[model samples]
Target: MRLFGRKNGEDDSAERIAEFWRWWEGARPGLDAKVAAGGRDSLASLAETLAPAVSALHSGLVCEVAPGRNAAHALVVTAAGDAELRSLAHRWALAAPPADLVWEFHPSRQANPQAADLTLRAGDYEFGVGKLVLGLRVPRGAPRVDVSAYHPIFSELDDDTRLDAALLALDSVLGEDDVARWVGEITAVTFQPIDAVPAVHLPAVVADLASEFDGEQWVALEGKTARGRPLIAAARFPLRPVDHPLYDQHLAVTLPYAGRDGDKLPTGASVEALRDFEERLTRVAGDWVLAAHLSAEGHRIFHLYADPAGEVRRQVEELAATWGEGKARVDVAGDPAWSAVAAFIS
Candidate 1:
């Protein structure tokens, strides 16, 4: 039944689940508050009864949530010790495979045919898995699963199992075309697939590919396999020229921009700005290097490839702050060995 951490006379699993509910209900205010505060003891008490059911699911359970829904911070931990115990609400649903599972996202006090129609809020967004409604109040025209970076805990099954978890996760936000486009972009079936290679040999493949496609255009679109099995990236960059020496040349020289007091941001920007920011960066720094593209999900990413100099680091940091808080990161590399840093925007 439940995996008990220690030999406690009382049901530890139940206690943990109850603790989870308390945290979940408190996560978003409004009606959730009533459920979280009013049913604290009872929820914990019910956890004792549900412990056996909850433990039947997956092993090494972990739940990752954006701290304060900050989007920039992704906090991850095991189910038992997570900061957002509220995520336990989906334990029952996540344990089952995609086919056997049924869920919904509804917050109103009404009966539905859905199995786990539950609701929970993360940041200002509402997440509904199955029949569950995560957020009590939905923002004006906010698409479901608006915030990126979430993984559904699926049971390990046969390789033939083509469960599109990414598509389903944000079905509320994405249309069929959108989902298809994303899947197509990330899991391009046109690429060749090899046999089940050794796990230890992945680094070698990456290294070889990096060397072969050094001057070529490429992006690790999705760090996942085509058949939902583990996969690596081999897609070549299609937008830019291969011999672009901008990124590489910049890696040779130390940065020149540093030491800013107030926000040293570039002026004149709007949502409809026709100029591509990535292209702008390339053009601005064009004097020393060739052009390059930023990652696909470039919303909150920080892309800076500077030389291996201490002063470069400081300048890059200042640039990131000035350019508005994005997914801040810095990359520095010598001829072969490349160094990198990356941060996620919440």
Candidate 2:
């Protein structure tokens, strides 16, 4: 389908009206004089057939066609998912009869015309449309047409019933300049809370955690040995790599912080630097994207995990090196005792 600019470009409304008139006048050529005199039916068999074909394709697309919009020479379909739609388009192209044609697909969102031309330039045809778009190609004499389509997220359906329903809803779009299809899946919410005990080693619970939280690893927030003081150990796990619904809940309720009310202790520059570095690390790591909570009961310590990406790591390391190697313990984990613990660590 080719859509002409009705507003930004030339006078498209006038162009459309002219094209329609030209097509109407040329409906029949060299008609029998006697039949013409008898006033033959205006509708022709070829026109009727072509109309159905056009309608079939148009019924599946997802774009809106205005009165002066460009004419549709092909079909456009909109599907529930971005990726799924692209995949289907590819399959259809592979099964189509060969012809001299150009086909392609883009895996990106729609672009504004001010930034780049949304026109698809392939061989002799130039299609200028907008939105997340894809195209297909069929070489002359090839048995199958080539397909190109865009990929989107959260629209995949492996089940036949769901797929069928989604296709039915999007059956109107034969082709579009802007089309967004399914891309990926949304992972289920999961949480793993590690148990910490003072002066004792906790049992490993990897298997249990895996079953409960879809293969998540659970580390005991405990010390290396039973004889050693049960210090707060770090429990690291991979987040779901996307926005979490419970993020605000986790932040407002979980961050262990109690600013000085009246009993204020002068914090040295070292402490200030550590907090600043921690905040930076949190921002880079996307630590705030997921919901996590620290319970009031566990032997807990709050520290920022350094971002392994830049000078932050080097700065943190250099700061640590300022003290002797063995003397860095008090700073790294803080004193493994109650008095040195932050008030929020309660």
Which run of 10 residues does model 2 get worst, by summed lDDT? 196-205
lDDT tens readout by residue for model 2, 226-292: 4443333333343221112112111121122233222221134433543553454354333232112
Report lDDT per candidate.
0.30, 0.27
Kindly report which residue stretches of model 1 are placed more than 4 angstroms away from their true locations once superposed: 1-220, 225-276, 286-318, 325-327, 331-346
Question: TM-score per candidate, in order?
Answer: 0.20, 0.19
lDDT of 1 by residue, 47-107 (tens): 4443343343224343332112222222222233221222232332233222211112211
